[model samples]
Target: MEKSWNNRAWFMVLPVLVLVAFSAVVPLMTVVNYSVQDTFGNNEFFWAGTEWFEELLASDRFWEAMGRNLVFSLVILAIEVPLGIFIALNMPRKGIGVSVCLVLMALPLLVPWNVVGTIWQVFGRVDIGLLGHTLEAIGIDYNYVSDPIDAWITVVLMDVWHWTSLVVLLCYAGLVSIPDAYYQAARIDGASRWAVFRYIQLPKMNRVLLIAVLLRFMDSFMIYTEPFVVTGGGPGNSTTFLSIDLVKMAVGQFDLGPAAAMSLVYFLIILLLSWVFYTVMTNRGVER
Candidate 1:
């Protein structure tokens, strides 16, 4: 006799499916529609084919923003990954200190993206911000508003501060999952700290490390709100990554067809790169 199956569970997910259709699928279809068509108001639209995509691809501004996005993501991963690993390695494996460290780390992740931007915006101000004023008081000329380097620095630092904790938490989770038997064997074998990390910790944490890298890469590549609120993609568009540039085209400039095309390209780039990252890492895991 066959037992019963809970096909009713499908009903539980129907609401979520409907909500996703309305929120994500509908908007995506609208964007796709806009991408292949042109309009000049009054609900009039004309077939534009791949014209907008060709124009966007030819634009130097788009390429420049893409370059910036790539650079930023690379820099963020370079800094955050090692730093998070270091922090996790050093964190107490047991005690009340563990809880304290976790809470402190989690606090940054809890702040809203917009709020993080605002905090940094004020913090980096030359006149009213502590950092700016401190730098000036120390006789260093610091101004995020006027200097491209300063703007980039402020944005990078803000992102590092906010997101490094997430990496730390992930790495910490990976670290804790490591069995004590491995450490005992290493200790019995007289393995150095470096050896332990290179052999035991790094290998064990590889999966979570991949996850951390992927998350940080995507977040950094797609970063907009913090930089937008802080710099408005300014100091002469020096900090304008793809998202900011896309917004300028779609909303500021109101070029829907081109913007829609750009958006699709952006989505594809992200999806492709993320797939590559996942494949490479998981394959390495399999090999090891």
Candidate 2:
């Protein structure tokens, strides 16, 4: 006998589809509309074809911001992924300390983005802030306000402090999910600590590691709030990522057409890069 499907579930999904249509699809369409058009004033829009896109593509400012974004994302991934895995490996596996460790690891992730930025902004102040005061006392020149390198370092450090927790939690979950049988087998084989991590834990955590890398990369690439709050994309646009540049174009300069075109291109770049990351990681997993 053939089984009947639950057609009522479609009714449950209708609300979600409608929500997405309004929230995502509608705004996307609006951006597309503006991207290919120019405006003078009073709701006047003129068909300009791909003029905005061409201009944005040819702009040096756009490429410079793109380069900054790529570098920041790479640096974030390099630091966070390995650091997270190491922290997870050291965490108490089975004890009362587990809950405490998890809570501590989650604390930073729970902070609001803007609040995190604000905290760092104040904390890094050289005159009154503890970090700044301490650094000054130690005879180190630490000012995120005027120095480009210092601004970059401050932004990168703030991001790591805020988001590394996410990677840690993900990796910890992956580590804990490995069954005791695997550990027991490894022990019976008299495997070294490095060997166990290499052959067993690493493979088990591959999926979660992939997730951590992708999420970190995307978040770092699109970082805006903290850096904006701290540096306002200043220090000569040293820490300005693509998101900050896009916002500066759209709101600061009111370049609607170019901003819209840039937004679409930004979305496509993210989508394409994410797809590449997923495909390469998944294929590697399959091969392994």
Off by over 4 Å in 1: 1-18
Compose the digit string of candidate 2's lDDT tens values, residues 1-288.
998899897998999999999999999999999999999779999999999989999999999999999999999899999999999999999889999999999999989999999999999999998898899999999999999999989988999899989989999999999999999999999999999999999988889898889899988888889999999998988888889999998998888999999999999999999999989987987898
> Candidate 2: what lDDT?
0.92
The positional error of residue 122 in candidate 2, measured at the CA in angstroms, is: 0.6
Per-residue lDDT over 66-114 for candidate 1, one digit per residue giving the tens place of the 0 to 100 score: 9999999998889999999999999999989999999999999999999
Error of 2 at 69 (Å): 0.5
Each prediction's whole-model lDDT (CA): 0.94, 0.92
Residue 197 of candidate 1: its Cα lDDT? 98
